[model samples]
Target: MKDSDSPRRRWWHVDPGGALGGLLLAVLSATPSLLPRAALFQGLITAVAFAVGYGVGTAAWLGIRRLVPMRSRPILWIAYGVLWLVAVGALSVLAVAWQNEVRRAVEMPPLDAVDLAGFLLGFLPVVVILIAVGKLNRRVFRALQRMSGTPVALLGTLTALIAGIAATVLVVMFGVDAVYKGLNGAPDAEAVEPSSEFRSAGAGSAIRWEDLGRHGSAFIGGGPTASEITALTGVEAKDPIRVYAGLESAETPEARAQLVVDELERTGAFDRSVLVVATTTGSGWLEAQTVDAIEYLHAGDTAIAAMQYAYTPSWVSFLFDPDAPVESARALFDAVEERWSRLPADDRPELIVYGLSLGAHGGQAVFDGLGDLRSRADGAMFVGSPNGSALWRTLQGARDPGSPVWQPVLADGREVRWISRAGDESLLPGPWSEPRVLYLQHATDPVTWLTPELIWSPPEWLDPSQRADDVSPEMRWIPVVTAVQVGIDMLGGEAVPARHGHNFGDVVTTGWREVAGDAGLDQAAVDRIQEEIEGYAPIQPYLE
Candidate 1:
């Protein structure tokens, strides 16, 4: 080691080990999420990113070492803090500009005090983690150094970098993968086994032996059967029903859509109340809460239909089922649209579209834009939408001029309303008539806001107190760190209480009531419907 005891030649020296330490720790912590994509490209991308951070951190440390006395811990820490501030200021502006570009807005947003606070808050955790990891790295290096017959500087640095990278891959392959496999829980039991045809829609319709899906998920009753419609909702309404047909790697897309349409005809659902055509993710799972809301609001007169596109869980679908969502949505919509258009206009039931998460992305795939949506469907509700959803992104770009991109008001809230909370329906100033839509997005849903730009820039939503009130103040936007934090946030997004986090729950009752645009939803009546929804156990049966 270059001696601090030496005079006149104490030039700033970069410790490659310390510089790369944080990157290694980050990969270690993020192994769980990254393990899903075990590919050469993923590893190369991660390694390149780590190398960049290593170079930047090395430069920062060397610069600080020259200016501050190494012996003075107080001054050194102060310098480190200032360096972080400088890093944030320089990087955050680029982030804001990128988000503006993504939003298709030309206006330049100036860096405010909140931006500074956000970066620093985000940086604090990162620094603590990196420092802790760096110390561990040193311990490992020292252990290696002791084992060596004679210390060699170049070999030691090379060994440490290699060890860090190897550790990352190893953790992903073993530790993270093992945990994910364990958490994958049991696959669909054979009991809820899927089938191609629809069964009877009578009251007290327990999932019979034949009712099991191809994938083993039972088609839990979305609404009471035809006989119970009067007793359950106290109205002469058609029984609400859902037929979820699971698609396997074994089946083609065409057959799946055909089976779904056939199920509609078999159960006599096409001739019933409002027909909702929804898209499911890999698991072919649908949110029961939203179905319950519609069933309650429509007084059991709704037919909610979703066909599973895959047998895998939604997270796995995200990594592997990028095209399955669009494919399934198109097939289902085309089949339903063809059938709906054939029927006389007045005689036909209203057609609507719905989805969430990957399902939401799939829902976006069926339409050209909001105009096409208006022409095709009576109403639609896409909840907890992903940031990359094409339709949602297009609407965001065409929103009201003065409204913030985060909460854009499309067409002055004429056809659509973006509601965060349950009663946020009150936020709408005017009435929504035909082609009504409601985009249910929680203010702090990382699934809806987190993007690739988070790597270098703080997202607009992460700025200051701009996030929803339920979000923690410490959930600030730090380069790289915020990305990891939010990645974890997505896993538990639905764990919070109702009306908060990514859990939309029965609030969708308000969404459906508004989207229906009928005076059928009286304040007192809707309140009772909401209570009925709550009485149904496990409000959110399937979390996206």
Candidate 2:
């Protein structure tokens, strides 16, 4: 057999062109992203970027080889190896510097020697394993191709590629389905029974406490008491009513929504000065701050109704069961609206819709247009709305030309407005209209901006002219790499400080006051409310 055909030589072969491409992207992957990433996450991003880069480089090289046949030399390989080592070593140091820059910008701790050690520990094995897998797959395909003449060989390779992809897709689908089922059925270890008289199923008329899933129970039982609010605001307050229905409470969305409405009716929720229809995240989790803010702003003269849609977290529900939120939000809103509309317009509570993250996506799905929105609800506040939201996209696409994409001015903020931080609502110099729709989205929020388009084209937010205040200036868009980085960023989006990433934090107080109409809150009162809510610890998701 010839040297090229030798098994040992084939097994050991490394493509110089591919290595160069991988190195280029691996270095670029270390640049600043939408959020600050730790050593482990950075390593994962680098490895994945390297793998993708290697594929692109390999494909390009193959195309070149087809056009002009050339053989590699030993001396050239030696020189290339030395150059590769120098480039990698130098770029790695730069990568660490870039990471530190991001950390400083985000007010996070700088990476140390231990972090570098951790990065290496996380990166090497993953890259090696990925390369090995790719080589093995290629070897199998080549072996099949070699079994017959040219025409048959081509057909065999095509057949193998199709079969492999189909098998992979099927395996992934089944595995993911099983995982979802397991998660849905799993009991929450942190779940505790409700003791609050104001909460659903807590010494109440109908819904059982046990039937309220972990998040459902937490939503109903948590938040400030009327006395707590009164103390903070220096005003008398009534107990805030919270009604929720878990997945186990009813089988279908319609049933659960009906149950929610029934609970609201029994609790005299419609009689309250302010009523909020809160669409919950995937695990039926409501942002404690979002609900608490409205209750405080209304001096506990508020009732919030929500229901569970899926058992998984927001991200999982986003990818797997995207329709659950849409379906559940529509059902709950329609049911509540039906009942509320039947009551005397002068006597009933002012209706408002609220949602965050996946909840926002679902809540926005309920409205067909601005007309539909104004016709149904008094006002709407959607925080960290996902890019996939059609209503959000429509409003944003038609935003005033001069306004930045991060926080667009829709119709000069006459009806719809977007805010990243407090006081943004007043930034737009236009007449404020009734039935206001406010989008509370941080400029750095991956949940609000990350999309498949990012894999190919640069988003307008990444443009220097349109970049947000919180986002690092060093952040640049790279095809595929930026997409992966931002996708990973979503995992820890809410872990950062308020007004950054996906964490809306205490800004919801201002947001609630703006959308729901401030009862009598002055700037001082709003500040006190923010301080009060800030003291409350974030509720941990039971499934998480």
Candidate 3:
């Protein structure tokens, strides 16, 4: 109060109330997202801030008059303000950094403009509430001010500081623990160990499940009968394993598939197996057009699964046995076999499944469909999937009976080997196909941010028609368009509609690669596959 009161005299005020007000403000600010009445809360918070300033100022003035020898008062108060400001700045940085790291580890989507705006607005009330608390606690401020010159003041300050430090430490520790248990969806780190028996043909890296969560492909029915699996690889075709990867767009799968095919061909694996590119252009709104184009390069079929694409629960209806995961899985296998039986021998291909986000969950459905295909035909691959949400609940100890992870499954009639990547926070009722899983991951991928318990509620306002169109100016620059188009062409220009964003390319690559060895895919074979992917459209976007 004195600092603003007179220019002639060096003066200062120590408002113990300011500290209290600040504490209250911080607590309130921390809950911006949960606030029920934004406008009312903000006004009350601001009012409290002003009151805290007034109380702290008045208390400081009176305490100086009652105790401080006249001249030294201003200097002490100035020092107090400086120290507080530094402390506040340091705390702010810590909070922001922690939030960012937590977000990344759990596979949460990047913050949008709305999230940023909310953050900015959220802090005002916090500061105001803290200031208000300080203002109301006049007696507390006066007590501290009276002892300003004595060792008592130091002791009092130390006590307050200690309490604050303890509270801060507790908050941080609790936040981290909560996030670790709830948001970090990965299995216990101790649970993951290296496997020596399973090996990817060309990957120089160690296989880890976390990496599989980030990247892996599950193949569905094998390529179309018209396509020559033998031509793609010099080896005679054994079983046609179809591939599927579910993502918002098909770009990731297409790119990874081409890379895998090329690598396999160069390594001579293709000489033994034929690995043709294929895509599953789901018959959802956004999928049809994209799949039709993708068809030219990647061989794929467009299958519409009704509204289940948007309402994940609808997968229950498609399951072989809605009441039991194991039974459902077996039923799915029967359906696949039944379908294969009907197809002219040459038209039927083996099936594998791959997915990411929603697609990953859908992969679980495929596994359910072809329960024991590995023993009968080939294997499966799954990537970037959350176990409960997308992959139905089929594994042991399933918490959600309707979990998507179990949807694509077959009965345990035979063993199926699976390849996966790390940073996939997907939780399952149990481990993957026993004794046959390989996982991989990159250290920097943000998908690591996900925890099993963390739930992401998509905004209900998103309109299906507003989805980005390949020809739209906004989407023209996106590389994924070309990849999706590859899948679309595979489906003869049919497209899956979109309510939820789906990535077809990611599904294709991951699924096919898992069963690649069985097909004997290799480098030269991949080049031919790449040519087909590039040949789909009249103009090659990759060339540009």
Candidate 4:
């Protein structure tokens, strides 16, 4: 009915401020979701559902207040307001304490400034909304009383409100999914290249030197070749060797591993270069940028060898057959280690390992445990490791009791360094010494932190002791709500800047300096290297 025809003013007319406050929250909560990879949408959806639920619950509470006798209406309102503050404050404090302890023990990012008062400040908006909603709810009962005499008017108003809510929900859900689809299939120039001669090889087939870098284009392969590397850095690139034995080349891992080693020997990799054995994701795609970082640090005296185990993209491979990484990783590493050992000890060059994302999961398969990893390779760097990866879990578990997961300063940063950002020296109890293990992770990367346990358990990151500043300080765990939210978090996990997500851009240069300190590359040299490596990314190939 039109306002003129209505018997009384609308429900929102009773408390305009309350309606405005709720509307503002709804907008804020949903706005970030419009961005490419904003994980905050998970919280936005939950807040909307919460508002709907609370609106219903508050209406019922207001109804009870009308039927029951109270000493004073003012006193009852004051009591409820006090209780809400107390409850919110208590929960925030307890959670912060737990989070602080864990972050300290693990050497994760520290949020010491997040005390009780600041914590409460974060929830100030929620408190305001609570007061507003309660007032609106009280007015709802009064509005009901005004409509009781007119049954036709009451039914029409109820129907309109329900329909409005449903329409809003549908719009939000459909809009989010549509945006996700568009981003997922966006085209890129590098992804258009076709494969070269690395597809199939016989038992004793020779390597195709000409077919390297997607048939000499240098724009279609994993890493820069010798000439490209030298040109970019002005350093005498020592053949910038890279060899990959495709899965189609041989029937078994043993054959593939041998093929990889054969190519390595052909390039004289075992003679004088530092050998880096990297494993690719399911798409058989390697991190050519990582290769560029190493070559710049080592002055092009490094050889990188890897083998294709699957032909699909990393995500598809991770979902369908996660174990493919484990199998191929173990096979390739075992084969390379066995052959590298055959060379004379004095002449044997240093061997390092690199694995990022799914490849990191597989590359970890070569070691039985941390002990084995320490004994086997000179150094190793695993970036954006998934929550399911065993090696990541082990070191994280071993960290001190109070450290956070995102940037744990494990065991005084002795043998291992878990880095989320630059300038992590404070996490180190002393100097950057020994075994030289570098783990690059970002607090915003859901792929690294999301797990089944998030539903049943409060994710360690939410403790407020050390989550990234980008994340909401008041984010709370609400069973299935948070699980669904984090599930969405995966979609835009890499949507962050190099310092924040799976996209670890220039930081790799810094990481290499720490892991390969023997290179004697100073800060200026590292900066120069970072710039050179970034230059190749524009034309770098994108694999399936």
Which candidate achieves the best TM-score against the true structure?
A: 2
Candidate 2 per-residue lDDT, tens place, 174-290, comes to: 686567546553334565556656678876647887677667777776778888988888778999999988888888999999998988888889899998998998878888778
Q: Write the per-residue lDDT of candidate 1 for residues 1-544, one digit (tens) a residue.
A: 4575232232233354344443554343333220121122223334444544654666576666676565886775677567656644644454444323322221124434665465445554555454446546655666666776475864876687799899998776566434533433233353332232333222322223333333324443334455554454455655565755554322766766776676677677777668888886446666666766776667666666676665455665677548888888898889888877988998887898998788888898889988898899988899888888888987877888766555668777887778876667787678676888779887656678777888799776655534444444434456776676566557656644555556776477778877763326557666666776656564332333
TM-scores across all candidates?
0.66, 0.89, 0.32, 0.62
Model 2 CA deviation exceeding 4 Å by range: 1-14, 55-72, 142-167, 177-187, 428-430, 518-525, 535-544
Better structure of 1 and 4 per lDDT: 4
**What are the runs in model 1 whose C-alpha is more than 4 Å off?**
1-216, 220-223, 226-232, 404-406, 517-522, 535-544
Better of 3 and 4 by TM-score: 4
Write the candidate numbers in order of decreasing lDDT.
Answer: 2, 4, 1, 3
Model 3 vs. true fold: TM: 0.32
Task: Sort the predicted structures by TM-score, highest score first.
Answer: 2, 1, 4, 3
- What's the TM for model 4? 0.62
* Residue-level error in angstroms, candidate 3, position 214: 26
Pairs that collide in candidate 2 are none
lDDT tens readout by residue for model 3, 196-258: 111221133222233221112111111223245445545443332222222221234333333
The lDDT leader among the candidates is 2
Q: lDDT for each of the candidates?
A: 0.61, 0.82, 0.32, 0.62
lDDT of 4 at 374: 80
**Candidate 4 — worst ten consecutive residues by lDDT sum?**
30-39
Error of 1 at 12 (Å): 30
